[model samples]
Target: MKRLIGAGLAVVLVPVLLLSMLVAVLFGSEDEAQAAPPGGQPGVVCTTAPASGSGGSAGSTTGQDVAGFSGDQLDNAAVIVGQGKALGVPERGWVVAVATAMQESTLRTLNYGDTMANGQMSSSRGLFQQLDAWGPLADRLDPAKSAAMFYTGGQAGQPGLLDIPGWEQLPVTVAAQRVQQSETPDAYAKWEQPANQVVGAVEGRTCTTTPAAGAAGGTSISLPSNPRAETVINRALSQLGVTYSWGGGDANGPTLGIHDGGVADAHGDYAKVGFDCSGLALYAYAGIGVAVPHQTQAIWAAFPHLTDRTTLQPGDLLLYSSNGAANGIHHVGIYLGDDRMVEAPQSGDVVKISSGIWGGNRGAEFIGAVRPGA
Candidate 1:
């Protein structure tokens, strides 16, 4: 009788246990799903010595070694870099000045711009293409004086890097944008790569920011141990300071203008933009052969759930949602290790790195992470 009772109890409990497990699988708790991803050895190992002798000492008059540039162009580039040093700007500042000059005037010290519709001069000139408001006409035309004005504001109170608080922490393009206030703010970003090369050649040493030779399109600093992860992170980093426009980027690249008028218009960002949050992730992952949807919710659904956040690798994504619902997912950022993340924040912002991904209300509720192509 005792043995028969025990057998009956076991038989009853087994089916209940099985059913409970099925329910758990079908409707797991948010805590269970949100468990942090595992952490371990870095997926990619990057080993490259840092470059030497960034910007030279002030007033050193050191000769530069610029290759593939005409004598006049090289001379002007040196003047720009030298003036940056004289103004106490760092090597990164030198790169920004040179790159800005390259885009504005090709270091040619232009004396004028196309006549306006009103038949008046555009009043833009010099390596930086300063307007007459930048300084007296003669000062705008003088290379050394103009470069100085570029780094340190001229008599007209035009803001320079020194004038902008925390300019050093901003990306090269952003720092330049703060000073130039160009109509096309993103144009300066294109010159960063070439500018790095020019600075490296001039300094007779590799620039710390120089991307590795043959790096996918020569746009990345170093490749990681995981080739795909390397491509994703590098491609994303290459877009630092790119404008955040709603529906502005796709797998291919940045689109011409803002395509979505709903949320983007609400944010007052209707101009041509670079990338939004999900769009940046989409493009970055696509570079590594991973297809991520442009919408945040779809991107979250596409990747396999990482059970442990600590295990998140470099290219993994940290997604955010307001209510933990499928449609609630609204933001995404790529993890860069050491608690850093790269993101194309909301309107009026640019692609940049932030210290923590979960500090703000938008990221308050942990929605777990996903590793694409892992």
Candidate 2:
């Protein structure tokens, strides 16, 4: 929910060329009977490891297909929902929590710190992207603990889900907003439909539903389906833990960092060896004999897009905007599957795996993903 805010912040809104993508089997038939939530009935650690069914659960960890999420992604949601249930955050809070997670980290566990638009490093992390003031990094990253923190309160005793005044009366998005107070007040609304779909999925039930009329979608993306995607992802992952030196990478390897004269200079990135966001991407695709440039937008424009952006696969590049504007694509990352990505997040940071999605900052939404190369 937080990220670097550099200067030169000119933003232009574009039509939200949003794409709604979900695996249909993840949301069963309308007649499918409702089953209890994961954990076999809403207890602590209500997590499930996916059954080794051959046909395709899309790496689902809950043993059942869940829309837009699988593996640890779905597990994170179960933790959120189950924790909310344990705390008795009202059934509404469960949906609100799921929706909120959808808004914050796309139900993935984010480990990277973000810098705000004002160019300040924000130590926000975890499923909900709680700030450093929330708790320790470990606590923030723990699904159950983070969910508990969201339900219980922040370190400053800020209200959690149940503490909000008249929270139950609020609509799903409204209830989520009360807890999040995000800059994008209405962003959570888009996920409301999917959130219910997720809760129903976890509970072993689903309802007949229709898309909310006028529902805006986020930028769509796809992970690598390219035959050489493995080479790209492995190349990127190989550089994990390298410092995020601005302008400091190439198709060959890490190079002397360059100074951006701002945050990059402040971080002494010029003296370091590493890769910036686009540089890392450039280096990654190079492993596949792709010579994309080191600029995020340039790389974005270098390749033709895949026909579909529905399923996020490993090695797809996720884009970000400082102001949530579609035209403000400022950053990029290599998707690493299971709602995780490897990125060189900011000047003082390191290239590492983060909970794969950005909720946008200063008002924009995460441009979803469409794989750039065929």
Model 1, residue 204: C-alpha shift (Å)? 4.8
Candidate 2 wrong stretches, greater than 4 Å: 1-65, 208-374
Q: After superposition, how far is residue 59 of candidate 1 from its true place, in Å?
A: 12
Q: Weakest 10 consecutive residues, lDDT, candidate 1?
A: 13-22
- List clash counts for every candidate, in order: 13, 14
TM-score of model number 1: 0.61
CA error at residue 182 for candidate 2, angstroms:
1.1
Report lDDT (Cα) of residue 148, candidate 2: 92
Model 1 spans with C-alpha error above 4 angstroms: 1-67, 115-121, 200-206, 210-228, 238-276, 286-295, 298-314, 335-374
Instruction: Assess each prediction's global lDDT (C-alpha) against the native.
Output: 0.61, 0.59
Find the candidate with the highest lDDT and give its number: 1
TM per model? 0.61, 0.41
Predicted model with the maximum TM-score:
1
